[model samples]
Target chain A: MGNQKLYKGSLQTIILKLLAQNDKMYGYEITQHVKELTKGELKITEGALYPALHKLEAEGLLDVEVAKVGNRLRKYYKLTENGTKETANKLAEMQEFLKTMQHLVNPKFSLE
Target chain B: MELTKEQVLQIDNYISACGIKYYDVKMEIVDHFASILELRLEEEPDLDFKKAIVEEHKKFSNNGFKKLLEIKTDSVHKRFFKSSLKHLFSFFTLPKVIITIAIFLGLQFIMNSISDTEIFFNILQGFALLLSFRLLFNVNMRNNNKISFLSLSITLRFFNVFHLFTILFQFLDNINGEGFNNIHLLAYMVLFLFYWSGEYVYYQNKKEVQEQYPNVIV
Candidate 1:
C-alpha cells in the first residue's frame, strides 16, 4: 500500500501496460490481477480502479465490450491503438520522473 | 433462504435511484445481489443475512459506480452541445446573414431607381412584412428552451397582428408624402428593444433561481 501510494501518478501507465498485454479485462479481474502481482502488498481498491477505467474509455484510449457471463453481465475494457502509443510514452515519462526524484532524494556524496 | 418481498423491492428502488431505469435491468441487478447474499447465508446459516448483504455491497463502492455513470453522461452532454451548436449555426450561418444584407441592398437600390409613390409604398410594405417575421423568429430563437414555445409564439403572433395596423398607418402616411421616418419603424424597433431587455431580465432571474434552489432540477 505504501509503494502503491508512491506509484499514484503511474496508475494509468500501469493500467495501460496491463491492457496492452491482454485482450480485455473486467473491473474485478483487473483489481484481482493487481493484488496477485503485488503479492497482496498492494490492493487496488475498486473505488479507485473503476473510475480510471471509465475515464480512459471516455477519452477514447480504451474500448469496452459487455458480455453476459453466467447470470451476470460484465463490462470488459481493452486498450485502443492510441492507448498503446500513449502507454509507451507515459511509461517513459514516469521512468524519467522517477529517476529525477531519486537523484533529489539521495544526493551523491562529493569525493573530497 | 428466501428474501422477503420487501427486501427485493428495496433493492429495486436503490438500483433505480442510481439511474438504472429499465425495470428488467434493475431486477437483474437486484437478483444478482440477492443471490450473492443467499450464497453467503449458505456458508454460515446463522450469519445475519442483512449484515452479510450490506458487507457484500460495501465491496462495490457507490462513488465508483457513480463516476462510471458520469462518463456516459458526460459523453451524452458533449454530443448535446455539439448538436445545439450545429442547429444554431444553421439558423444564423454567415451565408444567411450575407443573403439578408444583399436583400436590404437590393431594396435600397429599387427605392433609388423608382421614385414612384405606389412602388415606394409597395417596398415599404414589403419591409414591414419582413420586419414582422424577423422580429418574431428572432425572439423565438433567442428564447430557446428558456420560455415555453406556445406562449412565445402567441405573444409574437399578437405582435404580428397588431403590427399590420402600424404598417397600414405608415402606408397612409407614405401616400400623404410623409416619407419613411424612424417613427414609422417604431414597431420593429420596440420589439427588438423588448427582446434585449427580456433577455437581460431572463438571465438575471435564471441566476437568482439557480442560486435559490441549487438542488432543484430544471
Candidate 2:
C-alpha cells in the first residue's frame, strides 16, 4: 500500500486525491482520514503535513476558511480551481506508474 | 467544573510560546484544549484536569504546533514586504524633488557670489545628507514601516539642497585654489561610502538573524 521512498514524493498527490474525494478538511482531519483509509499503512506526521499545506496555500493551490466551531476556530482547506485540475493530472500519473510497477513485478502474467 | 486561574495562565503561556501572531487564534486554541480537559473531567469525576490536558497534548507531539507556526510565517513575510513598499513610495514625490533642485541651484549662486563661504558650507551640506540617510535606515531597522510620505519628502528635499550647496562650495574652493584641499573632499566621499557600507552590512546581518530565529515564536 505504501513505500518509504515514494511517500515524500507522492504526499501532495495523495492529499489532492483525498481532498478531491472529501471536498474539504482541516489539518488534523486530513491526517486522520489518510490514516483510516490506508488502514494504518501510511502515517503522515503533523510536521510533514503542515509545511506542505502552507506551501500549497501560498502557491494558490489551496484556500483556507477559519470557521468558529464551539470555542475553537477550525481552519478548513478546500481545493482551488488550479488544485482541482492538478488532482486529475496527478491521479492519472499515479495510476500509470502503478500499472508499470505491476508489469515489472510479474512479467510472466500474460495479460493483453 | 471550570479551569483554575493558574491552569488558564499556564495554557496561555504555552500558546504564546508557539509564536502565533494573532492573539485571538491563540486564545481559541487554548480555550478548545481547556474545554476538552473539562469534558474529560466530567466523564471521570476524579481525573486531574491539568494532567489530562498534558496527556492529550502529548498525543499530538510538541513539534506539531511548531511546524504550524512555521507555516504561518509565509503570510507574515508577505505583509512585511507590502509595508516596505508603502514606506518606499511615501518617500518619493514632486515638491521634495523640486526643493532639492532649488538647493542645488541656490548653492551654485551662493558659491559664485561669496567665494569665502563656499568651501565650508558645501562640506557641511554633504555631511548632513549622509547623516540623514543613516538616521532613516536606522528607523527602518527598528521596523517602523509607517513612514509619513510628506515628512520624508521634506527631509529628503532638504538633504538634496544641502548636498548640492556643498558641491558648489567645494568646486569654487577648488577653482580659486584656496580654503580647502583635495584631500578634505576625498575624506568626505570616503566617509559617506564607509557609512553606507556599514548600513548594508548591518541590514544583511539583520536578515540572517531573522532567518535563524524565524518570526514564528514557537
Candidate 3:
C-alpha cells in the first residue's frame, strides 16, 4: 500500500489485463475499479492513469470511443486487437517479475 | 448524483480556462471531472457542487491537467504521423504499386512532350494556388466557428508549410530555358503523390471525426 513506486512498472500490465477482462472503461471508472478491487491498497491517480492511457493509445494498443451520456461526452478506452495480443505478453512478463521478486525476498523458497 | 446542465457547463469552463483547447481533449477531461464530482457528492451528500468540483480538481495536483494536455497533443501528433506514414508506404503495395508506376511514367511523358517550361511552371503554380486556398479556407472556417484544431488539422497545416517551402525552392531553381529533366519531373511527381496521400488521410480522419460527433459540424 505504501509502495506506489513498486507498482509503477506494473501499471501498464495491470491496465492491459483489466481491459483484457472488461471490454471498455473510462478514466475515472478505471481508477475507481482498481481501488475497489485492491481494497484501497493501491490507488491509480489521474496523473498516472491518463499518461499511461495516452501512451498505450499512441502505441496502437488501445482504441477510443466517445459517447454522449446525459449532457457530456464520455471517452471510453478499449483494447485493440493488438492490445489483446499484447496483454498476454505483458501479463507473462509481470508474472515472471513477480516470481523473481518473491524468490529474492524469500531466500529459503525452493525454485521447484 | 447526476450533474445539472449548469454544473456541466461550469466544469467545461474550468477545463477551457486551464488552457486545454482541443475539443476532443476537453470533452474527455470534462467527463472525468463530472464523474469524480458525482462520486464525491454521492459519498458525502452534504458537500456542495462547487466544493466537490474543487475536491476532484485537487486530485489532479501539480498541474496535472496541463500534463494531460501535453500527453494528448503528443498522442495526436504521433497518431497523425503514423497514419500518414502508413499511407505513404501504401503506394508500394501490390495494386497501388502499379498506379504509382503509371503516375510516374505519365509525369515523365508530360515533361518530355511539353517543350515550354512556362507551361510546367504554370501547372505547378496552379496546384500551389489551389492547395493554398484550400488550406486557408479550412483554417478560416475553423477559426470563425471557434473549432479547436484537431491532429489532422495540424498535420495538414504542417504539409502546407512544407509545400510552400517546395514552391520557394522551385522558384529559386528557375533557370532561363533549362527546364526540369525526367529525373526532376519524377521527383516532383513523387512529392505530389506524398502531398496527395497526406490530404487523403486528413480527409478520412475528418470524415471519421464528423461521424463520431454528428452533433457537431466538423
Best-matching candidate per lDDT: 3
Q: Which ranges in model 2 have alpha carbons more than 4 Å from their true place?
A: A1-6, A108-112, B1-12, B18-49, B52-218
lDDT order, best first, reads 3, 2, 1
What does each candidate score in C-alpha RMSD? 13.1, 10.6, 3.3
- Model 1: how far residue B183 lies from native, Å: 23
Clashing pairs in model 3? none
**What fraction of the real A-B contacts shows up in model 3?**
0.67
- Estimated TM-score per prediction? 0.47, 0.50, 0.84
lDDT of 3 by residue, B1-218 (tens): 89889989998887778787678777877888988778777898787876666677788757858788788789888987887677557535677667878977876677678778668756865675566576568654555575565665566667676457566646754653465566566656666666666666666667767776666666
Where does candidate 1 clash, by residue pair? Answer: none
Question: Local error of candidate 3 at A13, Å?
Answer: 1.2
Best prediction by DockQ: 3
Candidate 1 chain B — worst ten consecutive residues by lDDT sum?
B147-156
Worst 10 residues of 2 chain A by lDDT: A65-74
Candidate 2 CAPRI assessment class: incorrect
TM-score result, candidate 3: 0.84
* Runs with alpha carbons beyond 4 Å of true place in candidate 1: A108-112, B1-14, B17-50, B62-68, B79-218
Model 3, stretches more than 4 Å misplaced?
A110-112, B43-48, B89-116, B139-146, B173-188, B211-215
What lDDT tens digits, residue by residue, belong to model 2 across residues B8-104? 6676666666565344245434665666566777789888755776675665556746666555555434433443345334434676556645655
